[model samples]
Target: MMSLAYFNGNIIGIDDPVIPIDERGHQFGDGVYEVIRFYQGKPFMLKEHLDRLFMSAKAIKLEIGKEQEELEALMLELAGKSGLADADLYVQVTRGVAPRNHLFPKCPASLSITVKPARELSHQVRSEGVHIVLLPDERWQNCYIKSLNLLPNVLAKQEAFEQGCFESVLVRDGMITEGSSTNVFIVKEGKVQTRPLSRYILAGITRLAVKEITGEQGIPFIERAFRPEELLEADEVFLTSTTSEVLAVTAADGRQIGDGQPGPVTRRLYECFQQKIKAM
Candidate 1:
């Protein structure tokens, strides 16, 4: 089925949605974006996603053209019109269109909203877990902002794919920062540890939810910078994202991660995450 998108102020076919060629987002990547998931026709953690979106825009000095409540209502309306009970809702706000220049455009900003079916991980990958590869972190310092500039992430992900891996676990200096497009976590002696929110990584909404879920389940959770050596010694490793949700990492750079299987702790959290979605 044809997908739908809300461009500027009009809801139209995804392929036909229009944006000015001089839009700052297109020219300078001066925009912030958020990806939210929907289940049973309702957006999951809608408020949290919106909060992050606003934060990202503020960090980059980009203005949201509309009110938060209005944007939320519009997203839900578009999601409903897309006819997908479970979907990925994407929202992007750019500095708008103006004459070609490096300066912020004087025109009002443009907003784009698109709702597409959520693609869950393959059953085999979910059951057997994924294989990851480590790569040097080549991104800019301000990784906290969810900006449209994704060339570094694209390169890392492409390298992983070329090497027959599902994702790239990024390493900076000697510590694990995050994945190319997701947050990284590890299990050690029954405790869950992930990188603390910093300029080195994006503060993932799913990562935060995972922390809360683990806490509610009485699982130990820690936020700290983990060395690459620590990942090798970890009982289990996984990734979290708006679309990927929770995915176990069974291998890294062809090295088996804890018997080369999805560890019990990961399975437990995966089950809990599924339940949370159903409840949502």
Candidate 2:
């Protein structure tokens, strides 16, 4: 089975010339997106992802015309066609095509759903842990919305990529907010902490799942911002996203994080998260 995509309600090969140049998403970065991960064949936390998608659309005043069920059906159809054991549904909705303008486009919305195989996280990183860098958060204030405007994140991640790192933790005003493309968490004094849901961070789906796990397993959890300096002081640090899932950060900016290994808390959380996936 080949990779497939749903463009404007029609399922087609991902390589097809379906998207227009003037699409608001392409021209002005006026769109919202979500990535749904499927383990085996079942999409993990699909409902939660879709709910966030709706919330993101509302944040940007973009109307996705299709009903929720209709959009879900479309994604299901494309995922079924892809036939990958582990894959991601890269779904986006834009303000349709229009002439160049800074204002909102007065047209229906456009949607694109692409299914691609999910690349497994590197074994070295998963088993031991990965190193990351802390970068100043230069993005807009609306990081809560998963919009297509990702130049800042792209640049930051690219810097990490060049530095031979797995990801970049973004700090704003001396506080650790999140990663360039993921939500960050740290274990300090045996307590799990991540920045609270705010305009400063993206509220990753996997992050919410981890939060639920911390509660179900009675792990100490706190939803408050922590300082960048505190990251090095953490006992363990991990990142979460649709693609990265739960990834440990053993170092940042060449400084060892938490004894230079995936600490007990991160490992246990990952194990419980795996069991949660199986139950799903």
Alpha-carbon local distance difference test for all models: 0.90, 0.91
On the 0 to 100 scale, the lDDT of residue 30 in model 2 is 92
Q: How does each model score on TM-score?
A: 0.98, 0.98
RMSD of each: 1.0, 1.0
| CA lDDT for candidate 2 | 0.91
Angstrom error of the Cα, residue 238, model 2: value is 0.8
lDDT of 1 by residue, 40-117 (tens): 888889998999899989998878978899999999889988999888889999988898898776788889988888
Question: TM-score of the candidate numbered 1?
Answer: 0.98
Looking at model 2, residue 39 earns an lDDT score of: 90
Q: Can you tell me which runs of candidate 2 are displaced by over 4 Å? A: none
Q: Which lDDT value does model 2 have at 243? A: 85
lDDT of 2 by residue, 118-189 (tens): 878778879989999999999999999999999999999999999999899998999999999999999998
